[model samples]
Target: MPSSSTQRNPWRYLRDADVLHAAVVTLLAVVLSAGIVWLGYVVHVWRIARRAPTTLRGRWVVLVFGRQLVADAPGADYRGRLARALALLREKTAGRVLLLGGRSGGARSEAEAGHAWLQGQGLPADAHVELEQESVDSLENLRHARGLLQGGDRAEVLPPVALLTSRYHLARCLLLARRLGFDGHAVAAEEGLPRTPRYLALLLMEATYLMWIDLGMRWARLIGHRRMAARIS
Candidate 1:
């Protein structure tokens, strides 16, 4: 049986109050940290959006990122992006185009499908067009494209690049392009479908991806610095 003194102890109450206060402070700290991270992410996205170039000029290569095709045909989003790319290709006569995407849901790769579509659209025979069908994602697309550009005769002179993607995806594409060391601009295509819950979900997913990439790059730099320091020491 517990004593009444023990049950009514003011010191016990004080101790519990202290613990509750500490817990609340810790929770608040975590929330504040999360808020700060979220704010930073928003600012990063905003900056990328602001920096997305409106005009593409010079000896630029149009990089059309691939989307999933159904029944070997480009879906509405992909069609919209392809249409924009076609328009750009027609307008920018001197600029070449590169279709970037991987095989999905069929034997034909996205890049291959894009090229075929453009040919079907009666693109000029002399227009410089390239296909990078091996990439699995946006990062891989840029990396592979860089390799293609820097390989062989073009190694000495890498041309500037312009990305054509959906409006929501353009910022992340530009971010990836910059990380891959390309003088890049972005041309955002109009969203083919109306804004739905899926669109918001995709935007959130992109934001998460951007955060992941930023963290990965920072980690790589830190690791590289440590390795260099170790070698020097």
Candidate 2:
């Protein structure tokens, strides 16, 4: 027989009905808040997907963002992106083409490889192809490309720019381009590359980036840039 003090009533430990109701309400509130955040992210991704292939007119510069090379050669995804850029260049004879990418675990920069490849592809000799070989990411690519453009004699031209990249990557690229004061449009490369698990992962990663940028975390962006530079270096 247990002593009176040792006897435990499990019901006694349970909260009063009012208290349980309040706890349930709090839990529901938290879950609702979480659901709202998840919904917002879903909407953001939907908008990005919808806007990925939107084209803008006027004098446009072709800005091709770079991806990592596989054994010093552009991977299938990057090859598709480059092929699209090349197609745009062939179709639009007015604007200059800028190949933007930096060295990442390679003997040569991505821009260098792109320049060489485009040259070999019979790009017209009169076409002005500029190489930006020092940008490690999308933001850096546009920022550096902007600097290059401003440094040129055509600084005052202020043409609407066309970004060539994977469809999943175009939204964030366009966001950064607008932040850098570019009147930009996207020309996505959705074909050739299979929609694999890696592609889904890339989409999630890009969504996180868009969220971070939207949150205006300057320090986070700086740290991310440093980390990328360290990885490539």
Candidate 3:
């Protein structure tokens, strides 16, 4: 027979084991969360690489927007890339090109520079290249351009508008285009572009904008239903 002193408390042993097991599980969960984030980022880049080019041809208008352009510029990478995108659009779609941006600090707005460069590349003067100089951001660019495409008629069906921008900017710009009721596709201009600090800036800005809008939109919807019920009551 076992002595009384030799008897063990099973509940205490179970509790101690549970605490240690919980700590180990928590550490593993943290590592798994980090791994999943990293894997998601990798997958996003891979998908972008696969779908960045526009394959459809003929008269599919391509719209490109970006920052100002400077002559004798050292790092005018965005504008340079914008120019390439414009040229590619001309070649691929054989459609009119509309560019939008603002002139800041004596540097030519991207719209102006793109028009000049496109014309210099032998694009037509009157209708082939149009410029919208008032927009400061991608959403504004698309909204104002969408108005032009619709030609002041709310009932007009939007054309297959295609957006051309840097690789990192395509996804967010596409979302903004859809939000503004643009029935269009987006393509990243992936040719002949240098490394861009603007890419990281755009990504951070987009993530912040999306996070705020998502939370705010959800709260608004919830409150909206409550207000509607109150009014009905």
Candidate 4:
């Protein structure tokens, strides 16, 4: 014999197979939808990595985003980026460089390490170069680099510049650069899109990071979290 209050609110009779099953179905739908959206972004990243480049004519500054150092030396990928930047310098097309990265799992900062490697390769002392040794991640890399470019005799607005990094990394770098108001194009460290298992793994990891960042930004903006949104803006 239940009280009238319980009987009137018939939802009190809800069982696991009743309301709970519907809840589970709804949850699955949401999860599936999110997965589809994430996969689409992954495809977009892949396309950016594989796109062929045309001749870059204008003189531009090249921003070599840093990778972590290994044994306090530039890793293979990091050296690739350095080599590409040096090629631009030798081609006499780009005249300036800003190496962006902080110390991570290494005694020396990535910028310092990369600069040392470039000098060892015989990069002249008189080349216009800048080191951004304080950024720890891609977003911060672009943000701090933005400040450096605009804070002095650099430029009121960015001049044409190249974002130099690994092909797998270039997608996220370009995304952050555009969000931070950079005027640039992607310059791959490697010449062709890699299909090796190792490179595929790199692509997957980069895609996940990109999806996380964009989804977080959208959610923050939706909730009117202006400060969170501005962190990436």
Backbone clashes under 3 angstroms, per model: 0, 0, 0, 0
Instruction: Point out the worst 10-residue segment of candidate 4 by lDDT.
Output: 1-10
Tens digits of per-residue lDDT for model 3 on 1-233?
A: 22233222324433554334433443454377865533444445435534677444666777776654456231354655555555665565637667766553334555666666656666634446677766666666887798788899878988887777766666666766776777767666665323558755655444444433333334445656454222111
Quote each prediction's TM-score: 0.72, 0.70, 0.64, 0.82
Q: Highest TM-score: give the candidate number.
A: 4
lDDT of 2 by residue, 1-233 (tens): 11233222335424544334334443454377875643465467646665565343555788888888888778777887777777766667337888888876577778878777777778777777888887666777887888787775444555688888887788788878877778877777764334579877777767655654543333324446444223211
Per-residue CA lDDT of candidate 1, range 30-140, in tens? 377876654576566645544554445655678888987778878877877787777776777337788888776466778888888887887876778888877666777
Residue clash pairs of candidate 1: none
What's the best-to-worst order under TM-score? 4, 1, 2, 3
> Candidate 4, clashing residue pairs?
none
Which candidate, 1 or 4, has the higher TM-score?
4
| lDDT, each prediction | 0.67, 0.67, 0.57, 0.77
Error of 3 at 156 (Å): 1.3
Clash number for candidate 3: 0
lDDT (Cα, 0-100) at 184 in candidate 4: 70
TM-score for candidate 4, residues paired by index: 0.82
CA deviation > 4 Å runs, candidate 4 = 1-30, 52-55, 152-155
Q: Name the weakest run of 10 consecutive residues (lDDT summed) in model 3.
A: 1-10
Query: Which model is ahead, 3 or 4, in terms of lDDT?
Result: 4
